[model samples]
Target: MDECSATKSTSLETLVIQNISNVKELKSKLSEIIKKGKDYEFDVSSCVKTLIKSNDQEIVFLTVEAISELVKCDEKRRTYSQKEIISPILDILQKEITTENAALIKQCFRALGNLCCDCDSSRKIILECGGVPNIINLMKKYFSAHSQLSMYAFKTLLNFAIGGQEFTNAMVDGGVVEMLQMVVIQELEKEEIDEEAVCALLSLLSLINENDTEILYSDEINAGVLKVLTNTADIDVSELCLDILHAQAEHDSVKTLIAKHGGIQVVCSRIEQLMQKFDHGELDADQSDVEAILKQACDLIVIVLTGDEAMHILYNKGLGEVYISMVKWLEHTNYHLITTGVLAIGNFARQDDYCAQMMDDKIYDKLLDLFDVYVSFGVQMQKEHSVLHPIEPGTITKIQHAILSALRNLTVPVANKRIIAAQGRAAPTLLGALLSVEDHHVAYKLLAAIRMLVDGQESVARLLGRHKSALRCVARWGHAGEYAGAAGEAPRLLAWAVKLLTRGPYWHNIVEVDGCISSLVNMLVASHSLMQNEAILALTLLAIETLKNISPSSEHPEFDYEKSFISQLIKSEIGKHVSILVDTNCAKMPVEVAENLLAFLDITSKKNKLALDYKEAKVTESLKKFAESRQDLSEDLKNCITGVIAAISDNGKD
Candidate 1:
């Protein structure tokens, strides 16, 4: 045979050896043979088949190693297709997974799992292998033993269900749901069972989607899972249970099961406990524990209230009051607890009545005060933690995000636009915090709040315009290439600011107009894609407004000065900046900018003064091309350009 054939044959023999002392040599040989391409599939398959037949557990374990290597090779080189080995390997794995050798059986499942990473073929293989039965058996027999093989088996089964609905149906049909119910009952019987078992069961349950709610609820699985989620003191297991319940809560039947299983009271009790802890300063104790509980509680509450039925139930049960009370505690001294409380309250305040009531209670003012505290703390913390500057360290950007979100929620337009107006430029502090913080979620939250503020009141627009330097600070650095973590949100915030300036009632004056235009022009020239898009849209809107505001009869003739402004706009550095705005994928330039330009050119044409003292070739060429290109020019555009041509001809006639 050729050298390649000889290498494959040698590697196949090495794969079958029950007592190979040199794992390194076996790995190297397999790597080389698989790298040889499709020809080596038969050799690798034959070796794996032989290893599966061997009774020795060590040899069975060796099959896992070989399969892992093959998978790695397929991933890196794509020289060998997994299709060649999948059927033969699964066939061998099934034959080896008998009850007599459970450990070896578990290892075989793991090997099959390594092959199943292909995702496409895994579901078919899993159903054919009775993967659910094997996984349930392993969960029952070996879950508490800290066996890595057992964990691998359970995890592999999880991958199958997570793949899609068909795989989930397979598990449900195979009684995996009943098995999980038994595990939950067993865990509940003991004051303490292995958290890993509970975690594994929760992971398995999380894979079930809305379609499987009937099967899970009919089997009584939902109630048992909720019991563990609400009652268990073990935070890890409790959190996992919450995750599963959250998924199930989307369905009406499953949500009813959660309520029947005492979920509402349990969740409320947990929130109350957290509040008490915060009130008594116990939140600082075992901070890791506090963080785990708070995060889990927040996630569960958010999920439970997400649906209309669930939210209606929560409101009837006075959960809104509890949320408001928690918002009050958010004003306390512990930054961590305050941050968590703020996040939770922000979500609760999304309800219109809840927000209105919170506003009536002056929650809006209190929430703003909380933001000030957070910023102060962040500054102090920064100083305390900084090695060079010795600056005051505060609650970081994440805390700032929570605080701003709460403020935004409490101070919404329907709730109270006046509070936001009073804050004036101080409101942009949230944007400033966003700039300083590295977290993307925090940055996005702040940007969303800014959008809301700009949407409500025009004074916020004037305030931002007055603070041009601050606006530039965020606009400039937010688009900087090196700054990672949600840099995109900054541009969105700038876009909102631009929208306010152009469309806002108060920012319609000429001075304010120029500032808004300049800010947009700067952002248009920036390198950030998100910022450029937002800037373009904003510039387009401003251009439209600028045209709409212009009239021949205005008391302030600046409104009638469209010709001079248009001339200056096209001639200035900002005019070239328009090219970047036009070329962007965002297509943000105002339709009015084009309309006004056409109007000015048409007037010049009609007045026979189109050639009046033009200096910039680019600008002159741009105008000339617009005149020459006759496609789809609006009536207003045609009339305006005709006016310009007539004016130029009249000048020539004179």
Candidate 2:
């Protein structure tokens, strides 16, 4: 900065240096300056230029500190481009502007780290300005002597390597991969582990090839990293170590090492101890940070045990921690953290001992509570045009699917139904959630969860009566999905739609009013056996309930709508389809399916006064043909067919 450049901004330089540390307390004053737009950038540049000329360490440090807070948020980051902020920061890192104060050097590095973190352009700018090589050089230089300071530069570089295969290859080319494993190996077993350096290296392996035997998969590296993790005192460091090991868990060698070293026991105990602290009010100093690491610990546990043997170990050692963590996160307000918690539970459920561990447990009640929270979140999603801010969309969805999956697994044991029914809202909440979802993929899993909840629990079915309207959304989805036509989506949908209405007596009115009858009509003749059979059963319920509600001879206007529905049902070709379905047992619809079909036919003939279509069309021969042809048919189905023949004969006699 020349005298002319210096003279033009002396007062601006003074103001920056004076208020740097006090900026947070006088945020409005700083915000007013940022409100200056381009002038703010120019003013900031001029002040830094002048401060650098002074050759004062404290002043430059203050300037770097001020620069940091200026672009602390997205709005500010966007305003200060790489050319203005990063170019200067790069110049400082290259030692063109030198500082003996470690605090100043660290903060200068901190400023660069922040600049690189939030923007895509920062990576290119840093690389273009030779910042990447210098950053790597600085990290390598400070790594052993001043590891805490090195951690800042390493984190910045890690943020750069987050995406773009090109960037990773560039990092590898720059010796970043070699440097990471060595640093991790060297610093891991010391009295106090360099967690930041170790964690940064651990995170980088996720983007690197964990299978490449040259570096990450080497014996020395695995044993060293595994040893540090299994024996580490800090819960957070152990969590990071679990992450690195998880990336390699796919390899048999890694699994053997981790299990032999008691890594599974270590993770379980750490998670249990950390969560107990949370339960006992020990994390009050930093609840959010503790919760965040808790989520990481939970997620790593999910990925670490990649085999049945490992899963068995985790199940035996980690059940109490898994249960406690899931309950804590399910009740947590942070949607992202909750997913990892759910993931931990879901992975545990895959092993019988693990899944069985939760049988008849009280923990599922919180899962039911999560069902309520997600329903509200789903409904809110429909109401808002934008969501998942401050949280990743993938994170939120992964968790939602995890919870549904966990519930499905838990519900596989019959006694778990008591937990769901105990909360009264779990069944209804899931039903209503189905109605509001915009994502068909999540809806698919949620439907499976709902099926499990109400499958054999009559009380759960009865509870669904409370959310009749959203359950009809189930019908709407079935209606739309059936037309998707031979795609996997259609049958998957029809399966749940049938499950929803298998307790049809509880939801018949909303089912009819919401136009589910049209979709159900299509299912009666569907090509899939599952859909066709469930359709027949669902129709039986609808026909029986509709008949019970409205008499065909009634003169009341309200009865006219119901009568019109009967006419529509007949017109929809249900009569013809039912006769055709009963005529064949080659597809092997279950006996209850035939019984329900016969029951539907009997009730329809009794109420509508229409001649039995199958018999009227010469179906007496078709029934005898089918009954004799299929000896493999169940005896109950034989009995149902005999009863159907009797009903038809009685009708003819009249």
Candidate 3:
């Protein structure tokens, strides 16, 4: 009565009951529904419910078969309420699969599989109704008798597993892993194997998180299975086999076996073939083939070769096409392709000319846009605003980590810094990620990129100073993360802060941020050599400003002396900590660090009314060594240390 009320006609349920003995009539009625599916008002699903209970196997099989045709040929699975039909179909499958009704079972599976084909909601309904466990059992039971049943089963599973890693993990949990291993083993044994079966295995393998513990490749010897599969003749077989191997290759032994056993050549060959097909627009049946190869090849080559040996002969093997293909994949809709491709190209960062290659290819400009999109998208998602739909977090993390790493790679070239600075968005976009991204890995990589970008250029450092939020983020994280244990973003971030703190106007904001003083104080005492060195040098700058506050003509300091963080320094125990640092680790410290420490003492001792006693400088053992030793320290350090000691003992000078 809603819209198609005038089209009231014979329900398929009526025909089903009337033609209990007539296969011809039942087939005719069902065929009409299959043809004019929208024209019929028949509760065909109800007829399915009736015939499945009739104990008449032919009627039941015919009824389910008719429903499958209607579902398959139309948009019912996507349009209608799939739950009403899904529950009944699964009920028939669960009960009928155990009986001797092969035709009924096959058509029942076809019905359910067709229903699950087009909609994620329908697939989840099937899963929630315990349909996956049932179908997997049917595949196990009927696999030897008729492989097509298992093929259909796997096709449905493939549909269920399509959208993401979690669903794939669900499939693997529901026994698909063992089912796929068996199918691969069987396909290898047979003279005429089913291509659908191989595709099924590949599709399932695609869902396996490159690091899924639930689908452990080691115990199954899936590497050997995958190695045998790489020589396949079909495009999907080649594409998916390489994808699985690419994921498995994240493990060292698996990567070596795949590479050592000619798998690399097979993968490279498929890439060339697929690229040719894609270029010619000839992938009529192999729709996802080219993108798959790009994804798999990029991931495999990047991880297997560059994963362990980044700056070596592994990349020198004429990977020119591979590199080009990766840059091209940056335009792909799937950011995974873009992400993995970026990571692969990043491996070449250590190579001499690749940075130039990436620039010539306009990779950074593309990455600039990609970085902006990903960072903005990530910010929107984290806020969970009403109008915005969030992308999957795993994918966002992949993209962010890749962008930061690729940007980090670009910064490696001493010359590309100018290119990145020229892009205008590169610095701001990277700075934007620092404020919004939740993942610390991305933050670390972003910090490292910014560090390398501003390493030597005082002009760019001053440019970065205009963004107050960026400065606060850097200073805050640099100070807070200074004590971060293990090798992490702390070293690079602190290094950048060290450079920026004394650079220009950015120095004035330090007093605005409450902990900037003690942050530098703690950074000086940090265990990492780079952090320690940068920290002392940073304090050296601050101490110069402090000296100007005490005595203006004492030195021609460039900083605005009155607004300096000098008072905060007195409260943070600057003199005692510096002496402690010199006493405990002077010899272990770098020569430049030793030099900067001496410079820090030079000014603090020159303070007309010091916070801690100037007498403490005389007792400093490290200073005594630098004063007495013949080790030719930097003239600046020697003079600073000499002045501090001389001031400490003007009475003894006579």
Candidate 4:
């Protein structure tokens, strides 16, 4: 025998007679045996025999407990052969299935569920031994008087159904649906029944495929489920029903049933009721409860508005009017309600006609006004106490995201661009919020909005250019914030800004490429990894553009900035020091390090113009490569490189 079996045998008598006084001691011994790495079948079989023969109920319970642990071990270790030893224990449980010792039978069924979950053979054995019928009988006998036992049986049945399609089909054939329906109906009639039963039914229905849902619907099993979802007083039951409906919303038949049973309307009503409670301050009774309700409401609205057919139904049913009214009401509340209302309105605005109607009604102005209000609030707080309002971050983030989303739907690019430009330095307020908010989802939304605004005309682009100080602010907050700046999200926003300034028509008219380049190069020189990546990305864009626009001996007076910027970039460690690569912060910097460094280098290089031999070699090498490559070199670039070469050669001659 293996060490596991030896340990099992040594403890068999103690488990069988219930003579062990210390529960912790027994658990410790069993745990040690399990860790011994040995076959425990013989010991399990011996314990099974002793448990069957013993008349002590506690001993029987102890033996079942030991067997359950061994079964779990076997499953984890893939010791399938050892499970056969528990077959006799099933017979003992079968003997205890009568009304008198129903509690004992319930424990045995719990053990069987655990065992079946592990061993396919054990599951089949359970089925062959009439486990389903026994559990069903128990479900009926104790479902009313003994709620705990009924819950046990319900849980066991759920486990059985989980064995696979065969078990699921067997369960359906064995009147499990009828049993569940009866319990659901019974629970509805009573003032109280086990919440566990409701949870079990929901779990069971969730596992069923669409075909099963169809079968259940055809058999009228859905009525009870729908009734509970639509009419129940219990919020938990209603929430579970909504979950079931949402999961099955994709099925045509289920969608029809939901529509027929008023699922959407009921959900909408509940949301409106919650909104009303929120407006009246009644929802402030419990923060957790309010949050849960809000989350459920959002999920339901998203589901209902997801598909075209459902959305059409919602619009035709006047959900749009109700939703717009809600948004109007939410224009002055706390940030949470405002955020939720904004999301709901954004979803509704996805339809072009509906969005046009909203625009016609001046919803965009109201939202922009909310943004102004938040900015004013932030500024006021900063002036009064020399510190910004604590809630200003979240408020700004939500309002910005909402306005951007609404603007995207409005599709009036010129008007939207003007609105974004009007925000001026306040645009950095949203960036500040992105850096400070604990929730990444909010930050992601805010970044998306910033991306849209920055991608517009020259006015908006220039506004961003003036706020170069804001970039370092984001970097600092990201470094000190709890979530490590969410690398994937923040970089996309930064990259989007860089891409826009490089490619957008607004690039030349509004942004000083040199100043932007300096800021980006400084960020690249920082210690943050995300900041460095974005900085390099911006630099790469600049390089690509520089290559495209510069040519040999062809400089225009207006190209002075480009020539001077590229010369400075190439001369400093900003290009050569690989260690300067840090993460992207998408915010302000601590100092104008990149800009100041470039200025310093330009002044010194001109003063020491005749003392730079290596500079000539470097410029000459770059020019030779650019010429030989046969690539389309621009006039400005060629002149820049040639001028650098001439300057260096002149310095070398002195």
Candidate 1, residue 402: lDDT: 71
For candidate 4, the clash count comes to: 29
Global lDDT scores for all candidate models? 0.56, 0.61, 0.64, 0.54
Candidate 4, run of 10 with poorest lDDT: 578-587
Best by lDDT: 3
Q: Give the clash count for each candidate.
A: 49, 0, 0, 29
Task: Pull out the clashing pairs in model 3.
Answer: none
Candidate scoring better on TM-score of 2 and 4: 4
lDDT of 2 by residue, 129-192 (tens): 7667776666666677777777777776777777466666677777776677678766864787
Q: lDDT winner between 1 and 4, please give it.
A: 1
Q: Estimate candidate 4's alpha-carbon lDDT, on a 0 to 1 scale.
A: 0.54
lDDT of 3 by residue, 194-259 (tens): 777777667677666543633447534456455556556676576666667666665666656655
Ranking by lDDT: 3, 2, 1, 4
- Model 1 scores a TM of 0.55
What are the per-residue Cα lDDT tens digits for candidate 1 across 383-455? Answer: 5664543322334566677777777676665436665567564466654564355455565566667666766
Error of 4 at 185 (Å): 9.8
Residue runs of model 2 more than 4 Å from their true location after superposition: 1-261, 264-300, 304-309, 317-337, 349-362, 371-378, 386-388, 482-507, 519-532, 545-557, 560-654
**Estimated TM-score for each candidate:** 0.55, 0.50, 0.54, 0.52
Cα lDDT for residue 314, model 1?
Answer: 52
